[model samples]
Target chain A: MTAATASAARADDPLAIDVHGLVKSFDGKVVVDDFSLAIPEGKIFGFLGPNGSGKTTTLRMLCGLLTPDSGEGTCLGLDLRDEAPLIKRQTGYMTQKFSLYEDLTIKENLDFVARLYEMDRRTERVEESLKHLGLYARRDQQTGTLSGGWKQRLALAACTLHEPRLLLLDEPTAGVDPNARREFWDEIHALAETGITVLVSTHYMDEAERCHEIVYLAYGKLLAKGTIANIIDNTALYTWRANGKNADRLASKLRGCDGVEMAVAFGADLHVSGTDEAALEAAIAPYRHEEGIEWFRHKPTLEDVFIHLTAGSKDNFS
Target chain B: MKRPFSITRLSAMLLKEFNHMRRDRTTMGMMVVIPLMQLILFGFAINTDPKALPTAIYSADTSEYTRDFTAALVNTGYFHIVKETRSQEHLDEMLTRGQVQFAIFIPENFTRRLIKGERPQILVEADATDPVATGSAISALNAIKPRVMTRDLKGITMANPPAPPAFDVVVHRRYNPENITQYNIVPGLMGVVLTMTLVMITGLAVTRERERGTMENLLAMPVRPMEVMLGKILPYVLVGYIQATIILMAAAFLFRVPVEGSLTMLSGATILFMIANLGVGFTFSTVAQNQLQAVQMTFFFFLPSVLLSGFMFPFRGMPVWAQAIGEILPLTHFLRIARGILLKGSHFADIQADLLALVAFVIVSTGIAMARYRQTLD
Candidate 1:
């Protein structure tokens, strides 16, 4: 399709990224295979996957940092292939690694990016970004000397300084602390409220829960995609929360039992889950009468569903 | 208790380092390739006492005596007469263009003066820009008079065989009359210094970005390939100029090397040569995966440029195949232009061919670098 027509079709959809059949491979190994998704504008979309599950690859393709082997799509209402430069102009991408110049100071890095985008009042924009990211005091410090959390904050500030319509973050909070991650999510929500679409990939379950919608990928294939409650409700897995003294120790005993797909310990409680309701009941029936133990039926959590989904998918390398 | 030096631990470290070394194929290949290249280049290609030096003859007299004299000089295996020009201007043009190293000028009354024992003069003008190149050939010419006249005077009726001939061989070392080596070397060093710095500094530019993980971010931005290339090279142009200025100052004051030609023209030509080297470095950066590979590639290019660019040795001294290879190097052309302008007081028109060569190198190298630069990670 022509770039204009492809873009025209998505104009009415209010989708920032509307790509389909996106396939990318490196050295004969398919990193992102037959991937397709449409993210509406101003939505916080989370991508959860194991390592090397094509999360970064898909994020790169969405932001025009990489081209798919055989795909026809549009990013920011522009053709992914022909109008990548246009897409890149309007989209902000924060890489999985800290990709800014380490030798440059925080202010210099921001000013460089600002000048690249040819923003008016570059010094003001750099100052505002530094102040907003709480990096004003450290503006003169080299980026290489910053802590991981501060570096992540600076990277985010640099990416959003131009106020791009869409932001594609690849594992943005991978090595960050919990407090910094929370602050980052708060900023993400604040940006979303200002009508910025964000597509972020992460391995954190809590982060996945914060997204308006999430997609679980495994081995270059999408396993499940929906809102947190929707995905949990869609799964047939029944979970029984067992709480007692030493209830977590019963995880190994309950594992490998008939119809018990996963029996994982969550701190002091044991969550036994399975797809078949009758078989799952029979396996947990013997534990129901255990001394001082209380077994109660509960809804499956997002982590439970993720583990179950990943367990079902075959490991490509192995 | 753990021992301080355990064989198992040492073996494990060795195995890990071996694995790391094996994984980087470029470094491993460079290790083997650099040594082999140096052996071939330094061993077989380099020749200090250059043979078969290109000679141009401007003889007013083509008599049997001149023929025998020319034959005797050629028999020395030092001078190879490539062109016999009638006009003195044509002979001068050949020397200025570096087409010929030696010019043999025989006077009009050479045969008659010799027959009358009038001590006729045979002027031999050698391009002494490179003193080492002409040193041996000119010394060889001193022995040629006896050999030629012994044959030519045999047919003549001379009562006594004069210990010395009735002829004079006046050797004129043009451009550099003193035959000072520093005069040639100092100017050539400017070209070599600029080449080494410009190529290496710009060569590491893109590779540093890639190695530091910043290339992904740079590519993801709205910048164009040409923008990146120009941005990376422009600052280095100023750096190259500073380096050129320092070298030129040192050559003039420290070594007392004469800047006979226009300093303005030298500055202009040095800029073009710097851009050419920067272009070559940019091309190398695009091909290299990491900074180490980039450095190795720079050294690989630098080795041939220094050895074959007539910087250390004479241009006319090497064989035809080696000269052909040297002709392709930008430094080879720059060395000639630099020496010609600084020492010979040559004008822009004189070094036009070498100037055009540097421009061509810049264009081709920049084109290759732009083509090879990746705008996307794919």
Candidate 2:
């Protein structure tokens, strides 16, 4: 599509990222295959996938960091192919790994980023970003010396300081602690509140739950995309939570039982999930009357649905 | 019960190392190719006794005596008289510009003075900046007298061979009268040092960014490839100047090598040559996948530069093919410009070709580097 049509579509639809039939391959191996996504402006969309499931590839293609093999898309109301430079100018991309210059000081790193974007008030922007990230006190310290959480915070600040209209974060909080991750999510939400769209790839179930919508990809294919409630309802997975003495030990016995798709241990409890509720009940009927065991029908968690979806998908690598 | 040195464990470690080496094909190729290439290049291409030195003949007389004299000089196989000029100024220009290494001036009265039995002087001015290149050729001049006199005056010659032609051969070793090797080597070292360090420093610049994962982030932003290349190269240009300054100072004070040309000209040419080397390094960085490969690529370019650029050996001594290869390297042209300016006091017009070659190197290398630099994570 031309830029005019893309902008017109955006005018009518308010989508920050609207891409379809995007296919990308590396060395003859398809990393993102015929994928389509449309995220409305200001919505926080989470991308969930197994490792090497093409989440990163799809995110990179959306931000113009990579080109799709055969695709047409618009990011921030600009054509993904012809207007990539303009799209890049208005997009912020946070890499999965720590990608800032480790030898440079934190302030220097921010200044470098500011200069790269040719921001008008470079010094003021850098100072403001440092203060906002609570990095002003340690701005002079070299980035390599900082902890993992601090490094991520600095990366986020550097990417967003340009005030991009769209942010593509690829596992931004992969190795960070829970507290730092929560703080990062808060900042993401705050940015979203100001109308900046965020598309973040994550493996954390809780993080996915916080997004307005979630996309689950397996083996370069999008298996599901919707709100958490919609995805849970679509899966139609029946789960039984067993809580009692030796309940966790019953996981292996129930794993290969008839109609039991997955039996996973969550702390002291066992969550047995399946697609067929009657067969699942029949499989667990013998254990229903077992001594010192309590079984209750439970709603399937997001992790259960995702695990089930990924397990059924083919491993493209093999 | 376990032994300190088990054969199984040692074999396992050896096998693992072998696997790693096999996987890194470039390193494996370099491991064998570098030494072999260096051996062939240094062994076959290097010659200290450089022959066929370019000589210009300025004979105002053009008589049979001068012809005999020129023939005798060419017969020695040391001098290759590429240009013949009647103007003494033209001969001087040839030598000053390094178009010719030696200038043979036979005055108009040469044949007359010879027949009159008066000892006439035959002046031969040798560009002795590269002392090794001129040593054997100058020594061969002494043997020419007996052969030329015996061949020219066959009918009237006595058994004494015409008393050595009734002439004195005035050998003027211009620029470096004492034939100091350091005068040539120390100035050439400046080019070599800059080539080695500047190429390595800038070669690692982009590769280091890629290896450390910063290149992805940098490419993701709105930066242009030219901006990235120039940004990586400009810092090293200053570093190159620092290196040049240190070498120049040491060459002046410590080694007592003269800087005969204009210091401003030297600095200007050095800056261009530095940028050329930085461009080469940037190109290597683009081609190399990691810092290690970048270092290897730098060495691959550097070895031939040191060997074929006339830094370690005479330039004219090597074969035409090696010279052709050396001509492509910035170091080769820079060496000529460096030695020409520092030792010979060559003018801008004298080293203009070499300077142009370096500028071309900078432009071409920068273009290649920018072309090779990826703007996407492909």
Candidate 3:
């Protein structure tokens, strides 16, 4: 939804975050433009963007870890500017980097975060978190000794120990294996089912599909925001998949064509997509009857939409 | 296949290292600032042969000869008459309070005795807590008897062509009669050691977290700036006490340095001093971006404290401006407290001013640290 309409979301669904015209900059360069978002409570909201696209900056702003250069908003019904401390108390933010102390044991890290929140029954909570993280047996091991997957999991557990109502995860599973990543997503969904709103930023398309709604940012500007189907449908992008000998090699030749917005090789098949259906059909007419080459009309995937959105925006840093 | 050292490769490495140095502006500034500071300190601030020491004079006689003798004392360039007391008790208070380094007491009927050829004696008491501060001034007193009252003593047989001295000048060195340097150095070492370690260690507290990428996590939590500052610095207070305990033990057992005052008072003062230093370190951590910058800032402060705080040099020897700078440092006041209690057995009333100064330092530095501390990553 547009920033203007964000406040008008249905009354029954309370917005965990409702921000408008949020702008932030660093060193005279804008890192996040006039971005706005509204995520209803209990929904897992996905944030998609490329490197240096202001995803982390926006997440930091939402959780009160950073102040917007100029903006007005509320997270969990508290003013983002005036009540940041109160907002921070209710919000759990997992940074993109592994920020927990490496020298501390897994149990110690969780205990420290618990103490900061002044949570009661800290011992019981820490033990439960250790078990939930599947690190009960090795809770005393130094966090630095754990692999990337375990470290990420421990960070998540530490942030959620306070049982915050809203969770802002910035690339929480960026460097994890497939199985660990899936497990992490399952935990996120489980938290959301308990009525905790989550705003997670990730580049993984599979992870994006797991969210109830998604927002795409490029060059510090919000390009798209909606459900998975709504975002893809909003692009109105047409696609064709070519499966034949040297199909993937056609990406280089088809990239700059007028009708082809993105010509990406998906394994053995080449998926070419564009907004202009007629131009795309005419552009691929020559290859339609080529020897040993077969082309079929294909539905646009979420990856296609993501690539199309990122390819259209300018880089703010440049 | 390559030579022992390729000139091009060497030049490349040199350029890279030079760029690294250029980019770290704090280190670059420290490199230039430290030597320049030392030069200014040694060339202008430090003086071994202290002159114009604050001295108090009390005399019962108002005769012209008495005025002439006092004038002769000022002419020696060693004694600066700061206060002229009416009674001997006032002179004693001035010396005990460290308000004056030297106090000269003229006995009753001093001019009558001079004419009678009695050779009456005048008492000159020196606060010998710091022997170096009083050594040369005592020697300067010896030269005074020869030239003083030559015209006033004329027509008196005692002054006929300067026959013997008119009167005896009896010098009394109080606090440390033997002029042992260890008494001064050993006590002053406590303040120096605490200042060095506490400032440097707590200086790295916040910046290390920032460098290790844990500061973001800490800041993102529900912790306040004061909470983080106190949490980081309070533990170092205990560390400072341990260091102080070791130094005190060494002073008592190894160096034979006497603790003349209440040990409880000294312990309390040491804690206040540590908090003041830790506050300064925490302030530095907030201003520095990384651990290296924090350390550089620490030395920038630490060098001046060591030099200008009068731990190594006579405090009154420096120019007024340098002493004024020294007055602002916590170490300067701490040195006074340490030396006063250890040497003079000073009570709370004697060292209360320095204690108040350290309390003020703790409040002001911690205030600035909290004000400069960024609550958000803005």
Candidate 4:
């Protein structure tokens, strides 16, 4: 993991979380199977996976909330097994749901959290948290009555009150409006700049693109990990577009052909991608001469590679 | 900015809590009304008074003298003759099997002895298991039969010959003195009140945090479970004391129930019981999924605690199997200890077993709760 981080990350701060062969299972079904990763400090790390692919479980194991069945690893330079409470103390976790007490006012919620950590000068701390989250005006409003955006801000403030070193955000902006989500992400980025490492799990393509690096998991296994450009290159996938005239017709013909892992029509254009360059060329050779059809090679987007990779993988649950 | 916690933070939380209480009517009502409602219901409804005690009459011979003696037993009202039998075998069975509270027998020569103006002996047998029940029935018999014997003595001097046969009657009540119901009931009420409010109010503490998502925030902070437990329970302990104080005052004022013993000792014992009960409530919070489930679990605890504690029925009156089941409950020992001290003024030597039992209960339940509670935060 140290080697992986040294070779890959050239950020201002280095890796803060490094783990190897992290494994966990429940009721004989492996939930996180032989996973490993290096997350750079002071940067947003995005974890993306389909539903029930062990994304949450892997995150739990990484944060020391759940123990891996068999693994040797370190988080914040402490042994993962022996130093869970120590890890928990310095780490902040934002669950998927809005969990703050609905009965308490926004100020009260933050104050209670402040006291739990036995923070000094609690009144001033609560004031700053309320003001910093842009919740000063609504400080007296009950948290249950607050809007999604405001509630998210309160949750964020409470989690960060103790100035934790790492924040594990599980779909932090899941239900917020687009503007609020953007604002929330901006604060997260700001926290990262202050040397607080953030590990975020998201499914939105735009959010995935915002991450410094993305790790993709499928069926409890780490399928892909790298920068956006690097992951595309590692898949060895070639993508081509046919738009003019018979694009739809050409898509129908390209389906199920050897070397063409995925082919789909996007409105007037058909995108075709595959791993084998020579076989793809041979398969599309006849179509290149087809009248009124234009073809051009293009750099594969992260979405294109993801669709192709998932299309070729088998469901582990079945 | 202040740190995660300070006196200011706790005060701020407390102030906000007060504000919420003012705005939230249901919570305020719970704080005010539930205690009073429980006080009235438990204080009056739980009693140990036994009514309509049955006694069997056994006559060795059919004679007018024996017949008149049977009539005297019937008028006492404390005992009713369930069966009239000729054989001593049935009398032994009736007494040993607890079918009757008492049995009386007249010898075959009782009338002849009376005719001769010599002493005629009538024997009364009483079950001594429950001292109060036995004592009350004995008092009634002693008061009524002596007057009858004196009248018979006058008749012999006037017409028969010398003096009538002398008769003796004995009265006995079991478990309590003079059949006082308060002796058994006051102790049971203490346990019932502790079970109702302490387990319920504190049960909502952690679930409130979990529901509010503040628990995650707390977990993310440097606070340990021990600190959270202490901070969470300290306030509720105050509430528990308040509840205990109200119940004690009500019991004394409304029911005309005297302390008869040290109030300080009662309060001290109550604090230990509250600590045990609050820990149980904390455990419930960890087990329950939400506020609703927590309340449900509390009532589920309360019903058995009330029924099996021997509050309504004499412990002796219940079948041995039921008695064995009753012994497992905290209320059983709590009632015993409360009764022993308040009514009997029992010293530590007399109620030591009950105190030890309550201590054991506190240890086992709290240990289980602490173990499970830490896991929820973990």
Candidate 5:
């Protein structure tokens, strides 16, 4: 249980986390239902979902911090049901909010965590954590005075200081700037290189693509999950872009039209999608022939998949 | 128009404060109700007039004279005959069991001795469990003594002697001779008020950050729960100590309250109770999700601590079930220990149980707070 013994990764061991048929409910409402996945060791797995799609709950359940309603899992080679405490000891959770000791200096905050873990040479551990996080220069500064980016860095430093094998980040870069988000992702990738498995939930599409793999959840149900190309290739829908005056108005009118599965505004253009390419073309032929408008065949983006999937999905919790 | 300073900016700041106040109805209610509550607590419940004395009568003779005396004592309303025994053997049992506060025994030659111009001794025993109540009993006896013995034989003085105030009344002020209410409350309020303000003020301090999205960095740190709990509570403990000392000094100098006991013991008790109270604050912080809710929760705890804890009311007078509830409050035992140390000069052994209770409270509260805080960390 010493830090030296705990610091090493258990990579040669079986899956860092493995769960199947994970179901979770709150107040008789199912939040995460029939979820199953296996996260390989030393990979940054990204969880992408529209808000309130049970992403956070699924992550919580997978980490052994929460028990599923009817599913079973193992985290860090220990049965989650019987060894949650042990699993928690080795898992680091970086919450979306800045949840550090504001009144305490950055160095003092790290020292406190080091002491909590009962680590030997707390000062050395704190120094090492700060240096690893590139926060040594601002070590003595009060954590409250730090910006969002620095706060994110400090949070990562603290969780990793105890050298947890797994890190669960709940929208860690939520309000962080693009540069800081990139830096955070870089640190996450670096942690992964050391064989620390990282599971991150995010709202940004760019961040999603940065992960080794992506799992998309809508209304507590996984819609499409794989590499960006694979997910796009699996969908049978074809998209056509329309550029014109009041294309936003056209998108509304195309919804409920035959063969037009989804019509969504993409900036100054409207991207129309349908599983039946002929019917889709036929439905948009009249609108395309109108004045002051031009149409072109377009490739489907992740945004198109998200809008199409979520529009058709029922609000299960509501 | 360009030259004018921005009154709108100052007004916006003031408006922001108003909006905050409007959003937090709990604070608004506290502001409106606290003054009225303080008035009732200090003015009404805190009183020196201890009434309802329980007593026992052991009439061994069962003569007409003994019966009359027993009837007179019962009719006075000051004594409620809690136990009536046929023999003196049960008198000790009654007092020890706390079934009756005092016992009076009229011996065999009661009427016969009085006819021989000899003073008959009417025995009286008082249970001195509570000194304040015992003092009132002794004072009441003192006031009634002359009337009992003289019997108002107007314009009739004996040629030999003016009936030399026929009988004497002996009173024992068991614990406190000069019964002063401040001697008890001043030291206790030092603990109670310091506890009320410090625990509640710091209880929500960290929770506020957590709610406002600032706690992420806190959890990210290398700090442990105990460190965070201590760091948050220690500054407030020091503040409580300083406030307690100031209050105690004020009570002594301004109120002229005497600390008949050891000041060191009182201070020790105060600090111990203050730390226990901080543990309570930690519990509140762990349970409450926001600063407003934390304040509400702390006050919810504080109201009962004031009412049932005997800091404002006498614990002895309450029903046993009610007293059991009071015993659960830290302030109750704290007041008992502080009053015993400050007013009665009781040694450490006398207050060991109170100290143990406070220590247990601190341990349980700290454990609960840590466990709950960890569960909700994410």
Candidate 6:
């Protein structure tokens, strides 16, 4: 399915990443299967998937860190295959792991990155980046000695020192504290507002809710893509909430019943959802009259829709 | 109630180690292949008693007695006549250039002097640069006198009854007249030391980046393959030069090994040899997966170099196939060049062929390394 057409937001905006049928394999095992996307400029695009769902592979191909086995695409208006070096020069890619030299100081790491791009006014830019990340006092500290949050900030500063047109972040906020993650997102949003397009992959549901749009992948396939509300609405799933004493206990019993695709506990309540409305209502009919229990119709959440989509897809490895 | 070491835990650790060994196939292959290679090399290739050393004849007198004397020298199985020249300069040139191990010069009237029992002195000049190569060959030279003394002349009869020596064998051991082993070893040590350190050091260069997970970051940058290779290799080349200089200084001052040839020429040859070895190290780094494997590859190359390159044994003593393998190693050629300059005082013309071989090695190894250097993480 073409995920670009599914999203109606900013339909007329120019695309920063326009890829089609981006298939990639390792040792004949397809890691990404016929993936395609068209993300507009200056948008915070979230890539959502489970483990081994081709999110990292797709991000690597977009940033020219890896070549697709067979694909045709343009990243920042340049051919990905023929103009990789050009794409690399204009693209800022933050790898999943911290890839900067650990032996170098924070300021030195930034300076080295600036040198690699052959950027002008290197010392001034490196100083500004060190100050921007709040690492000015510790600019001479070794990168290996930084905390997880500081390392992530330093990596972001290093990749963006050249002022790239596009930024590809692979789980940029992973292993970071909630406060630091919020600050990181703030910086990302700040960058996006300045007309830099961002494509970030993450597993945090709250992080997913912050994106202007999201694309969900499973089994190397694009299962859904759109705004969070659009995806939740498109799922057409019916949900009911049961809030009372021991409402969480009913979840295990409701699960595996016909028409009950998911029965998950949220604190003192149970959220039961399914795509078939009538069968779902019928499945919970017998529990509605229970003593000391209250039931109410509910709106399906973004996490509920993702869980439903994941259950419908087959695991290719199995 | 835990025991100091449980049998089950010990067995589990043993099994885990065995599994790791099985997974690392290169280490396992080396464990088996290196011993077998050493056995074949030591058992079949090495010969302490070298024979058939190339000899040239410069006979001013061509009589039946001189012909008999040359035949006697060949029959000792230590000398093989490779050339026959008339000029005295050509005979000395062959010995200096190491083309012939021994030069036999017979003065005029050798037959008449021997018949009159005048005890003619027949000079035999041997290149004693590698004393081991000429040790048994010189011993075989002594046996020729007794064997030829008993041989009867076809037409001429001895005036005196062979009581005095018919002809005296004047064995002149050249280059290293006293056969000082240090003279051969100290110069060749320059080549051996550079090979040991330079190859292993640069071999770890790229592999360290890869093992540390920095190569991916390096590849994502705009740097080209040649740029990365040279950046990694050039610094180590300077280190090699420093090492060569130290060894040369020690040889001159401590060992008293004469630097007969021009220092500029030797330095030029040393630079070429160092680049060739660094090229080899860089190529090995590209092929190996990690630092351990890179070091193993260096050992595999260095062992053959030390053994077959005539550092520990005579180069000519090895079998034909082993010599062919040694010929491919840069250390073998560099040894010849170093000894040629420091010991024999050979000029550029004498060592040009070895220099050309070193040039070819530098080109081919560097070309292969550059070709194998991955531009992308693919």
All candidates: DockQ: 0.23, 0.22, 0.21, 0.33, 0.10, 0.15
How many residue pairs clash in all the candidates, one count each? 0, 0, 0, 32, 19, 0
- Model 2, which residues run further than 4 Å from truth? A1-13, A315-318, B1-174
What residue runs in model 1 are displaced by over 4 Å at the alpha carbon? Answer: A1-13, A315-318, B1-172
For model 2, how does the per-residue alpha-carbon lDDT over A1-318 read when each residue is reduced to its tens digit? 000112112355599998999999999998898898888898898999899999989988987778899989899889999888888878999999999877677887887777666677878989999999898999988789999999998999989988999999999999899999999999999999999999999999999989988888888888888888878787778999999989999999998899999999998899999989999999999898889989999999999988888887753335
Candidate 1, B78-115: lDDT as tens digits: 89999998998998899889999998899788888777
Q: Write the per-residue lDDT of candidate 4 for residues B204-252, one digit (tens) a residue.
A: 8767767666565455445555555556566666666777677667767
Give residue B59's error in model 3 in angstroms.
Answer: 50
True contacts reproduced, candidate 5: 0.19
Best by DockQ, which number?
A: 4
**Candidate 3: lDDT of B317?**
92
User: Ten residues in a row with the worst lDDT in model 1 chain A?
Assistant: A1-10
lDDT of 2 by residue, B3-71 (tens): 223333233223322333344467445433443343334334544557799999988787777788888
lDDT of 5 at B161: 24
- Candidate 1 second chain TM: 0.59
lDDT of each: 0.81, 0.82, 0.81, 0.74, 0.72, 0.82
For all predictions in the order shown, the interface RMSD in Å is 16.2, 16.7, 16.4, 4.6, 15.6, 16.8
lDDT for position A296 in model 4: 93
lDDT of 5 by residue, A1-318 (tens): 000111123456458877778888888988888876667788787888889999978877765546788888788787767766567668888766676656667887676566555566777888878887788998878788999888888888888887899998999999989999999999899999999998899999899889987777877777766667667667666999999887767988998899998888877799899879999999998898878788999888877877766766664334
Q: Write the per-residue lDDT of candidate 5 for residues B195-262, one digit (tens) a residue.
A: 67767866776677668755543443333455566666665565566676666676677556667788
Off by over 4 Å in 3: A1-9, A315-318, B1-174
Kindly report which residue pairs in candidate 6 clash with one another. none
Worst 10 residues of 6 chain A by lDDT: A1-10
